[model samples]
Target: MTTEASGTSPLNHPEPAARTLRYSAFTHDPAGGNPAGVVLDASRLDEAAMLALAAEVGYSETAFVTGADEQARRFRVRYFSPLAEVAFCGHATVALAVALAERLGPGEIVLDTPAGEIPVATRVDDEGAVLATLTSVPTRSRPASDTELDATLAALGWSRGDLDPELPPHVAFGGNDHLVLAAASRTRLAKLDYDFEGLAEVMRRYGWTTVHLVWRESPELFHARDPFPVGGVVEDPATGAAAAAFGGYLRAVGLVTSPARISVRQGEDMGRPGDLLIDVDPHGTRTRVTGGAVPIAEAGGPRRS
Candidate 1:
């Protein structure tokens, strides 16, 4: 069951599977950006079943709609990586929102996740594509310990000199925790070769969902890459949670003025380029991440163990 990417890994547990939809988030094209599995209705599934289904789907993460309030357009959603459950996932959230908008009509929806209540707004673009904007929960960030930062750099084969001294390294949290490391140059960020096992160990120990590797291209433009070993993925193409966390990191370090919109370009090195738009409000603590999603395919079958 294990692939060459990881040795001797366990397969997804066998379970009665539910119908799942596949979509690519953060890109208008179905072939671009990050792909996510969305279970529009998962009320009948339990946590173990959800986890198994997520592994079967084999995406970076899958989103499950556990509860729904049709009258208010509110839902209880849960996110599960292949290996375990995550508090929240931005791209999946966007995908789900767009999916729902297509059915329920573009508007606002409330998602109650383990992390907190997230407000998502949906709109139809001029081209008739559904776009979603998710406002993250209150965010906070703090400096990473010197020891932890050093170990992480070693795992990524990065050094202090390669880092953007002004940005530094910090553990930032939007809904999920991510270690934010700003590279001094785009070239440094592009050449990503990390010890998967080592980085995974460090992330698990620190409760980090991903390592947000970023390089500022301009005052409001950035290039980002996320190492998501904790999710059993080599990298994430468009990480909304990490982008939100990075927005928080920028605010924490006084790198960005408030009420600003930032653009993040990701997945180019991996050959699936995508764009994520982040909005920071000077009056609010939450950051908003916006993107579009398109259906890729549909799947429904029992997962083999």
Candidate 2:
């Protein structure tokens, strides 16, 4: 299998596809959480090949493990959505970390992503569960422009009154930009039939990864649902990128004081319940997202031809 990495065009495309792995991120059960595709040995694959395999996996995003520094335990990783390559993907990162831990013996791995350098730490718990935590790139949040907010609302079929007065509309970035909309009532967040093409257009215009719909149940607990039309998925069961972004948004909006640990419950509405733990530092720009992932035994999510 000749590849661009060796200054040659790839002749056998199926070699790369057979190496893909399928895992569900943010949950220990394969049936729960967001499904992610990981290619641990994607060093031989190019961008176009990665994108094609990601589409074939039919997941929101896939993480390709590329260049590596074995001495430093650092690796170059790339994220590709079904439609295009993205800067970063949090759930996919978690899934990749756990998958790598199984082979690398689980301690710490640094990932060089397009967004920035990400540090992931993996630990085996007392119950023999592998937990992976990813520290996001510097995160920031800003109030959404009125025009942007209006268009998003229109696409979501939501009016101004449906929004929470306290949690105003904002664009938050953990690794990618996500539109954070706080619903005043949990009921409003439950029913989420939206205009797919309309939202995808708006997201592409604003460079948004997903629309993060949230409802605060308590100070340290929240419920979340993500609309990922831009990724060619109707909804992402669990969104680690948005959760990291939300931690930044909470601190920016005075919703939480510094150095807070909160839990975001997601995928429940979709019957694939997963929980993401977000830790915000008092002085650091990075937010930490923690979750567990398990491989799918039945389907590997790659079409080898």
Candidate 3:
């Protein structure tokens, strides 16, 4: 296996260095959300270098802005997990948008990601906080295969009896694919003790980025937990991609009556609580996720072992 250092020599060289910024996404408090590493200018770095930086950052995922068109406020963004590159990441995208908004002033920004083009709108709140809303690519959801569902439940130590019959298991996609498993109760969702390797294998086979474990509190309120074994993380504090996908799932399954705005409370079980706002249009194909991010005080540097 190639080590991170051997994969990229840019970190050792002096010229054309990249600057990384750390931000906690989906929350105004730096300590209350998912932290993501954002490289504002990564045009000089190759895939190997980006991967190395992501691994060094030790975050579930990192956002790299490789190319930018200043006049149009457009950028080419890539996402890297600690273990591999992902097609898209919701929290990282929101973090990158807020990071850019802080510098360029809040407005609309277009991001070209591996999955597709995503348009993000940023605005300053009454409290002087920058919030970003990203419209995802067209979303779709389908019932999970019996084999995959059974295997995933076994890996999670959950049984069919533990599932909420109203919200059936599904494979949902907004920008990336996720397995949506709605637990019968908040207690069932709280007790998350899954076999990491087992879940990772299942996720890899299905090309799923995360397993969205959720419990509905009401028509518009929910609590969610995401198992991101594929990213080498046991759980994600905040998951925007999964939230958008879940919106699509709710609409697809007829759980939602009309165009609705849903609020997802996540990370509470892990003690790093965050909130995500999701908007589903009755006539639109895509879902929009909104959240706020704050910059972490720590300067970006080499990863400490």
Candidate 4:
């Protein structure tokens, strides 16, 4: 596999470096969705190597494909943040799925993540972008304890009055845990100044991957903003894992009808608008998050290793 970088040949790059591909997930535009790094063949890279590469890429998370069974379309995917390994990263998963679809053709691919087994379906759109939908692990949610709510609110500089009365705060789990806090208005959701260290401390203590901050625009429309200080990101433009968790939160709290499909608009405040389509099944606990991803401009085209 050869990807010609400017002023250099990929042949000279050894191992995982030559296999890295960058993409933005949850949007067809590069300037939209959250950027992610994908290493299609990381068979030779150790945990240290992966972490270093992730820091160098500086994306919210980088997905590394450590093992694969080509004929069965099954692979083991690991996600790494700049600072540490993440249990699961939905945006990176989508990015990797689309990148693989471009080379291996649109189809279903199974990923074994640290969180659980994930099945992603990919298809090419009319605009020539590969759209991917990932079925999250079993989702669940529970009301946040008073202590938890108080700590998070203190860190976020938000009070109970600022929260939506209809959607109560909860701890939701998709592949990982997330604190679901619904802002009373879009204005409240947009202004995102918070104590990063304080929030990170709270998140770490609670084992939360992100604070799934959201505002309900309508029965089916919503605006979301995710503060991912724990991941070493000030903000995440598009967060598929959190979106999936929020879906479970919504359904659990009776905010949406079962067998619902809702649209989540995120990253708009950051100028990188991304849209996620979440489908929550009435009978099943798993949620499906759908979106398209685009190759980062500098990567040029399809790459493989």
Candidate 5:
């Protein structure tokens, strides 16, 4: 099936089924987190078509819910970036969880993603908005080669001196692979200008999803940014995948002991600031990423064919 939604098209056609796609994984305020396009019901969309729709949505990622089973809790979920389909997306998962909570009532929901089964727990906050926590897949970390590290640094226009001596280079995988590079200074993190195509080539070669550029502000807090050229987006405002990977990065390197929580402030550079909360547990292999989301106003326009 082919489906489309147009937010800005002069030409007109039959009214497309409109679902308010919000930028979730945000905090209480809508503008304070990563933006995600949420399509609550996407049974009318096909694989190719969903990819196109996600591209048109122009966010880091877009989530489509195909259907829900009898219990009204289990759903088949798919994620698409601007460039292609992704196995999973954490922020989008949070957005979907909140959306589902509103529709199905506050509780837990099982999302069957291509990567694996994701269980999202949702609850109403003090202000009565839905907040969600998603348990990620088993996370693992591996050392990054010297050559790979040098090349990645070069692509980002940084030298070895700019790297934080405490946190060395490591490639971590939660739901996806991310190359974690800690910045020596917040100044370095604020000034981000990377070779998009060059880095994309390197990432594709290494099967990396995003380059997790981060600065350790404190023991329990960090500032982060993610370059996602592979997904046809320059940056990801809020990235759950990177957060999960970071949890593993901290653990493998002994930066953070088991059973800890970290706050990641992202999207501040983009003017759409957002927050991501990551829970690290030593008992289990999986990392938990949590956040909140809100819906955006629907834009008026014709359907895109």
Candidate 6:
């Protein structure tokens, strides 16, 4: 493994650091999707250093891979945010899958992540990016108590009336926990405002990764946003973990029944539009999330000298 100053490495410093990571998760379009930072080799960076680097890069989450030789395909992985390390991250996984596909040619890759072992299948499409699908760990869902739900609603300045009747309130876990809240109207989903510090405090106390705010646009599609105050971010335009958790939520609550596939269109409201696919099985333990990613730019490409 090799290390360079933040943004100075061959992969990161062609012009801006964003070019180094080759993924636009949740969408096939390279220009219209969630961007994630993926480092194929992270052995050179320690935990604190990785966290600092992630903070500097400022993506919602960055994936670091360690303990894998060049000859091997598997990697030990971890994810970090600006403030701390997390148990799992979906977008980063998609980004890593694309990066691996770029290097090893399109194929299936297995990652030993902090949350669990995730298997990803990758292939390139006419859109000119490597598409990857990650099967998440077994999912679990539980209804939030009235008190907990009240505190959550208060943090978002939302009332019980704003919630969708079809999807009830629940805390869903794919890898980490998310409070799933469905908005009754598309207008409510568009108008996103929340208590920053207040919500952060509550989220930290409850060990929540994000608040999944969604409005179903159609039976197979939805508009989504995530409040990640716990990670010190106000919102995430595209969230893979929340998407996986939502699939579990839908199945557990009978919203989608069993053996359903759905697409989530996110980041549109934020202008960095991305799309994600979710596959749920009535009997299978894992849920699959799929999307495409591209190298933001070429390594050693032209730069402003």
Worst 10 residues of 3 by lDDT: 1-10
User: 115, model 6: CA deviation in Å?
Assistant: 0.2
Worst 10 residues of 2 by lDDT: 2-11
Per-residue lDDT over 1-305 for candidate 1, one digit per residue giving the tens place of the 0 to 100 score:
11111212111112123568888899997767888998877777899999999998988989998877755788889999888999999999999999888877899999999999999999999999899999999999999999889989999999999999888899999999999999999899999999989999999998999999999989899999999988988898899999999888888888776589999999889778899999987566889999999988564211222
Clashing pairs in 2: none
Summarize candidate 6's per-residue lDDT along 1-305 as a digit string, tens digits.
22333544333344343223545567665566666667765666789988887776676778887655334456678898778899999998988888777766888788888899888898888866678899999999999889878998898899999999888889999999999999999999888888888888888888889999889988889888888877757777688999989988888888776588898988877777888889988776568999877666532211111
In model 1, state the lDDT of residue 130: 92
- Please write out the lDDT profile of model 5 over residues 108-170, one tens digit for every residue: 888889889888899998988888989888888988999899889989999999999988889
Cα lDDT tens digits for candidate 3, 1-305 = 12122223332233234777899999998888788998877877999999999998888889998877755788889999888999999999999999888877899999999999999999999999999999999999999999999999999999999999999999999999999999999999999999999999999999999999999999889999999988878888999999989989988998877789999999998888999999987667799999999998984322222
Candidate lDDT (C-alpha), each:
0.87, 0.86, 0.89, 0.87, 0.81, 0.79
TM-score of each: 0.91, 0.92, 0.92, 0.92, 0.90, 0.88
Determine the backbone clash count of candidate 3: 0
**True-vs-predicted CA distance for residue 1, candidate 5, Å:** 19
- Of candidates 6 and 5, the better by TM-score: 5
Candidate 2 lDDT, 27-141, residue by residue in tens: 9989898889888668768888999999888888899977766546787889997888999999999998898787667899999999999999999988887899999998999
What TM-score does candidate 6 reach?
A: 0.88
lDDT of 1: 0.87
Ranking by lDDT: 3, 1, 4, 2, 5, 6
Between candidates 1 and 4, name the one with more favorable lDDT.
1
Q: After superposition on all CA atoms, how large is the RMSD of candidate 3?
A: 5.7
Q: Per the 3 Å backbone cut-off, how many clashing residue pairs does candidate 2 have?
A: 0
Error of 4 at 9 (Å): 18
Candidate 1 least-lDDT 10 residues: 1-10
